[model samples]
Target: MVDLYTHILPNVEKGPRDVNAFLTMAKSLVDQGVKNVVASPTYNGQDLEKQNIMLYVEAANKHLQHAFIPLTILPGQKVTIHYRLIQAFEQNVHLPINHSTKYMFLQLPNENTDVLNEQILYELQLKGIVPIINEPERHPTFLEDSDLLYEIVKRGAIVQLSSDSIVGKNGRKEKKAALTFIDKGLAHIIASGVCADTYESYTLPKAYDMVSRQFGTQILYKFMENADYIVEGKAIFKEQPERVKKGKFLGIF
Candidate 1:
């Protein structure tokens, strides 16, 4: 499965010791059967953070062109697109894309979001860029406003649900919200936003398997296949044969 979201800090030195902490974390995932991972930088880092991201992007792009299952780098950050981003755009500091990098992974604030978030997405759309909000389950405000979530998808923004939510790693509240979104067909993708132990933690294969066992294989497969599409930059739509109700489970497959 393609892990659509991850964080891997680059190693500045050579060999294994040269890489950052997250690389060691990611190495564990590789041992667990995760073939591809789309990684990005953390919100905070020191010098050459941008350069590190670029290195990952450039390297991955070259490998992907040859069908090599190299770890892919999405490179965009979690921070808001403020003066710095705008200035970078003005100076063309961002990586040039070819109809693909149009999709960006946005990390929303863990707490409630204001109208500015909506504006940020709107502006991104205006620039022909689609914002894929990561881990909506962590944001309580989103669960409180399902209509707003629907609106975001309606306006062409995609929601990425974390795989751990199904197994309750994110806590009961996040699990419930994730189920709500999936049962209602509001979620289009599920990724193991795993940091460490690729084999043990954030392993999509195991997490989804457990979910399939409990929730039935159909629900699990729906998210599994949809996850593939999201990584390929395909648009996923809500697929419900009937209306969804709270506290009720729907057949997902």
Candidate 2:
């Protein structure tokens, strides 16, 4: 399986501190049946972080070769959303997923959807890059305004659900939101947003099981296939998202 979102790059962002820490995390991922991992360190309009992540990927894969683990690390960045996003991409300041320039992993603010600039996303799409919103299920604004995600997806963006959220590792509310995204068909990808310190490495498999049990094996298959497609830099298949009703209970607008 391909893990599209992860912070496993050593000494970069909030990922592992050293090579040893990264190796430990990598072993955990291998144990969880992850054959490919996209080393997506946080990138907020910076080039140095992306360089560091690449350096680490090169080193990590070399070490994994001797470790006999059948895993390959790829380049990616979980870029923070900003109004200058379009300029950053145009200037080649921010890195896209695997440097493919076709898919980007965008990190939205947790507080509200007001910070999201739909035009920037539209501009990226116009340039033939698809912005995959990272962990929208954990954003408070998305919980309060679920239709915001539906509208974004309708406008040619994709939503990536956190594996930890599906397994209730983040919290109950995030779990509910994750399930809601799946039930509504708003989620196109299920990613192991694994951090070496906080998130459990095995949760990705657990999430696949949960999705299979609740949503069916077909949905689970598509979610997993999307990860592979992202790694291959191919077009992803997306189910039509149903519009979420507003004024629902539990602030699920």
Candidate 3:
């Protein structure tokens, strides 16, 4: 399986802290049946590694090869949303998934202004970058007002639901929101969080199974295939996003 959002890079904030952690993460992913990963490290926080992401990917690939781990690492970055995201990409300050210019993993701020969020989402798409917003289910803004999420996705920004959210690791509220997003056609991709570790390795398969059981195999396949497309820098699949009705998920709000 291809796990798009991963932190297996050594020393990157969410990746293994050292050589031992690196091997441990590699084995954990392999054990979880993941054959490929996009080595996405968060860059917003002070300690998160933003530059030299390719170097991290290289070191991780080398480690996997030497250690006989079967997982392959791809270059990626997780950036917090801001007005300058497009400029940053143009400056080559951060990487898109698999080093492609097509897709990026975007993390929404905890506090969101609807106008600003929509504008950035629109502006990113205009720059030919599909901002795949990460884990909207767990974000307070989206949790309180699902329409904001609906409109952002409607404007062509992709949604990446986290596996932890789907499997109830984040909480029941997030899990409910994740499933509802799928049901409402508001979410396009599902992946592990930017931080990769042994504890998270098991959630992907379980999320897949849960989604398949609830929504059938085709939706499952679409999510899986979309991940591959992002890696190849190609267009992603999408269904017309429908507004998640108000009060449908009030408990989460």
Cα RMSD of all models vs. native, in order, equals 5.4, 2.3, 2.3
**What's the lDDT for all of these models?**
0.59, 0.81, 0.81
Model 2 agreement with the true structure over 1-253: per-residue lDDT tens digits: 8889887777777678887777788888887788898888776665455566677788878978887778788988888887788887787766778876488988775444454567778888899989999998888778777878888989888899988898988888888888888888789998877777754546788899999999899998999998888888888889888876664423342
Model 1 lDDT per residue over 143-168, tens place: 66566677777777777788788677
lDDT of 2 at 142: 82
For candidate 1, give the lDDT: 0.59
Candidate 2: residue 68 Cα off by (Å): 2.8
**Model 1: residues with Cα > 4 Å off, grouped in runs:** 11-27, 43-51, 56-76, 81-99, 110-113, 197-199, 210-222, 237-253
Name the 10 consecutive residues with the lowest summed lDDT in model 1. Answer: 9-18
User: In candidate 1, how many Å is residue 115 off?
Assistant: 2.6
As for candidate 2, its clashing pairs are none
Query: Which residue ranges in model 3 land beyond 4 Å of their true spot?
Result: 45-51, 194-201, 250-253
As a TM-score, model 2 comes out at 0.91
How many pairs of residues collide in model 1? 4
Residue 38 lDDT in model 1? 64
